[model samples]
Each structure stands twice: as C-alpha cells, then as structure tokens.
Target: MPYALPLPLAPSWWSRLLARVPVRERRPRLRVVAAPHGGGTAPPTLTELYLARRLDMVRLALFLVDDLPTAEDVVQDAFAAVCRAYGTSLDGLQDPGAYLHTAVVNAARSVLRRRRTARAYVPPHPGAGAPVDEGLLLAEEHRDVLDALAELTRRQREVLVLRYWSELTEEQIARTLGLSRGTVKSTASRALDALERKLAKRTETGR
Candidate 1:
C-alpha cells in the first residue's frame, strides 16, 4: 500500500447524492489499524487517528463552513496533510488529536478564502433532522451580520472566524496562520469593530 489518504465515508442520503462521481479503484497506501495503548501496542498511525476522529471533525467542519461538500474537501485535504507530515515524528505530533483538530480548523479557514462569497457562519439546516430552529438562526439580524462579515477583507474575516467560531486561542490562530499573536489580536479586534459599526448602521437604518 502507498499510504494514501482515506476515502470520505458519509452515512447520509445527502452524501450518497453528492458522491455519485464514483470512488477511484486505487488502494490506499496507508491503512488504519485499531489503537492498542493497552489493547496492544504501537502508537496510532495517521489513518487510525483520522478514523477515530473523523466524525467529530466532519461535523465541526460542516457547522463552521455551512457547505457540506466543502467541509469534506477541507477535511480530506487536512488528512492528506497530516499523512504527508507523518514522517520523522510528524512535527512532534505527540498529540495526534490536537494536531488533527488544528488542521481541520486551518482547513476551514482555507475553504473560506476560496469561497469568498460565503457568510461568516453557515446556519444549520433543519432538514438535516437535527432539532434546531434554522429560521431563528438565519434571522434578519444574523443575516445582516453575516453579510457584513462577507464584505470585510479575507484576513480580518479569517481572524475573527478562527477566534470566535473555532474557539482557538490567539496563539493557536497565530501558529496556524504563521502570524504573530499581536497580529492576530489586532486583526480580530479590528474586525470586531468593523462588524459592530456595520451592525449599528444596519440597526439605525432599520429604525
């Protein structure tokens, strides 16, 4: 086996619908074996770690990114990256869980950069059978906020999204983006200020 990235596995009707493109016939170079800290031995390999954490990651990415297809793309990319770095202790990845989490977050930001028209947050779908009020989530006020976020520059939007949505510390965001903590804080505060101004303008206009 060549240790390639795992194929996306979706257990949803939507997934089947979207995945009609046909899975390739190629075999994986990397195969995930069951973890055995006490069950056996050998630290979890890249694939094993990914399989253990895939569902949560997929869910988080979908929520953060709104678009299901894009979420899969982001995760797949991140997984491939993790695999690529598995050589030589994988950047001291002593904590695979943390590494994957960070990778997913960074991937989500990358997706936002590509789909520049997307809002700051994607509202959850009521149709997905998850019990949440989609209408309330997508209310006029919230819509205005997302629209305003979309209007801002990508860097500002990214900093805010990572800080607020991903719940990443300033230091984490800085490391992920290869930026200084001061820069991350400055961008986030500036973004928040701009969003506030826009929201105030919108509220005043409505009144």
Candidate 2:
C-alpha cells in the first residue's frame, strides 16, 4: 500500500531487475522556498526532489539490496527520514541532495543489517520469481556485470557502485559510507580485481 515510484525504462540489466515495481499516485507537492543562498536557485521541494532523483536512488538501492520491492522500500524510507528531519520545504539544509543520497545509503545498510538479524531466527524462504518480459531486453554483458557485483562483499559492492554507477568521487564515497578516503580507494581497487576475476571465470566456464 506504500507509494511505489515507477522505475524508468532503460536497457540496463538493473532496469530489468527493477522493471516490475508497481506505480502509485504521487503525494501532493509541497511549497517550494528559496535556497539559503541569496539570488541562488531554490532548493527543490520534497516532491520535486523525489521526482528527479527517485530513479537514481532506486538504482543505488537495487544494487545494494538486490530486490525490487525492498529497494523501493529503502528509497521511500530515505525520503521519509529527510522529511522528518528537515521538513517538506527542506529549509536550512545546506545540501539537501547530498543528504538524501546519504540517507538512501544508510537506509539500505539498515535493511541489510535487519535482514541479517532476522535470518538468524527465521527460516530462509525462496523468493517469488519476478515475471520476465520478452520485450524488456538486457545485454548479456550487463547481466554478467551484475552477477559479478553480487559476488562482492557488501563494502566492495557499495564502493564500486558509488564509484562507477553513481559516479561519485572517492571523497564522496568515503563520506557516504563513513570510511577513510584511502580505504575507499583500496576497496575499489580490490573490488575491481575481484570482479574481473569472476567475470573472466564465467566467460571461460561458458565457453
């Protein structure tokens, strides 16, 4: 019953993974206000921000958590947290966009943490297979890359996704993940090497 932002259509494999999220009516727009800076462009109202960045945040969450419904929940929780902390107008927050990005990352981590704890007490159940569409095509290479990413440790996946997919700088990734810049750089390097190994092995096995 929660609001589900429709994932945008794209040829990327992640888009395939996200294609079935149900759409919901958007909440009414909040009043927009001038940004703190004089003569600067106004910061987006919470609704505007949701419209513009929801797809990207969902992509980030999908990569982190690897499930469409859970990813949607993570993003919704992120926006709710922002609204709770800064209100709908988002007044007084110097960098609301960055804050929202961090919120998504943190929310995804919380989901993973809670999932881990739940698994200790609950029996694992097979997930319902998402219905596949013949019309929604994904490249084989894209599928391979996603499979490779899944083999990565959570920190490695976070570093690589933030670095390459999100196009965040090392410092930005460090800030979002609460790691030192050096640690981010090293993790990215090691993650890339491990990913390459996995992809290469897959290729050889397929041959």
Candidate 3:
C-alpha cells in the first residue's frame, strides 16, 4: 500500500491553477493531510508517519523534481535522514510531520543541485516513460500545468508548491526554505504571476 493516497481533496489554490481549463469539478490527484487534532496523544512513530504521509510527500517531491522515480528517491532519502538523526520513535522531535516536510524539501534541493552539476544530463524526451507511474495518475490538464511549471525557476517552483500544494503559511514556508517572510511573499507572488503567464501562453499557442 505504499502508493495509497486517501482521496482527491484539492485545495482552492489548485482550482485556481487550472482556471484556464474548462471547470469540470476536477480535483488535484494528491493526498492532502488533515490538520492535527488538539490533544495529548503521543506523536506518530517514524513508521506511522511514513505510512501516512509517504505518498503525499512523494507528490510534493514530484512537483519539485518533476518525475516519479526521482521523487520517490527524494522521499526515501528524507525518511532515511530522519531515521538516522531521530531514530524510529522520533522521541525528541516535537512536530515530526513538519520536520519530514522540511527534510523532503531539502532533499529535493540536493537533487536539483546534483542535476545541475552533472555534465551529461539528458532531459526526458516526450512520450518516453512519462505516463507510466500509477502513483502519479495525473490528468492531461494537470500534465499541461506541470509542463508550464517546469519552465519556472527552481525557487519559484519551490515557493509555489509549498505555498499552494502543501498549504503552508508564509512563516512556515519561510522557515522551511530559509528565507524571510518578505522573501517568501514576494517569491510566491512572482511565482503565481509567472505560472499564470506560462499557462496563458500555453493556452494561446495551443501546443
């Protein structure tokens, strides 16, 4: 059940991202974690956290890294880092979910860094092993958006994904990305504008 996600419950921002397409009541095919209830229950163990959030984190990493296999690797490395540092019980961590989120983000950055430094990286050609991941059962419209997203700068994509997909607040995104609140705000603003322009151009060009 490693590929299992709860259901399609997209946030409002996701709809906005697909506004260019005809509104069909479609939701983003990603797992959105519910807010934690207020109580004194013990924090989730590392295994519990992985079982609950692995697919969701994979989707997040997909947005950052732009492919399924690499995204899965990013998530695996993130969890491995968490286990190495905190062990299975996650005893000393107050918010394991947030820590995991930050780990995934950081791991994705490392992947992008390595990709940039590599001398002979070949971009994935169209129609070659792109539509194969069952865990990433994204629609054609969603793929269009992803194509446009790939045009954005890595920082812009990071800010937009964390802000819209992860539903993180400005302060949380700033802390996760190690930028100021002001920087996060400006980055998200610019990212959204840029995404809209890219999507719009896609619509106009009909490509």
lDDT digits (tens) for residues 1-207 of candidate 1: 212222243222213222332232332223324444654323466656665666556645754565556667888888887888875234346566557767887888887766554444665444443224433223232445555666677677666655554456788778767789999989877877787787678778983
Question: Which model is ahead, 1 or 3, in terms of TM-score?
Answer: 3
Q: What tens digits encode model 2's per-residue C-alpha lDDT throughout 38-123?
A: 75656677888888788778777877887767888999999999999988877667676678879998999999999999999999
Question: Among all windows of ten consecutive residues in candidate 1, which has the lowest summed lDDT?
Answer: 9-18
User: Which residue pairs of candidate 1 clash?
Assistant: 1-29, 2-29, 3-29, 3-30, 4-29
* Alpha-carbon TM-score of each model against the true structure: 0.52, 0.75, 0.77
Candidate 3 achieves a global lDDT of 0.75
Whole-model alpha-carbon lDDT for candidate 2: 0.73
Ranking by lDDT: 3, 2, 1
In order, candidate lDDTs are 0.59, 0.73, 0.75
Screening candidate 2 with a backbone cut-off below 3 angstroms (N, C-alpha, C), the clashing residue pairs are none
Query: For each predicted model, how many residue pairs clash, with residues at least 3 apart or on different chains?
Result: 5, 0, 0
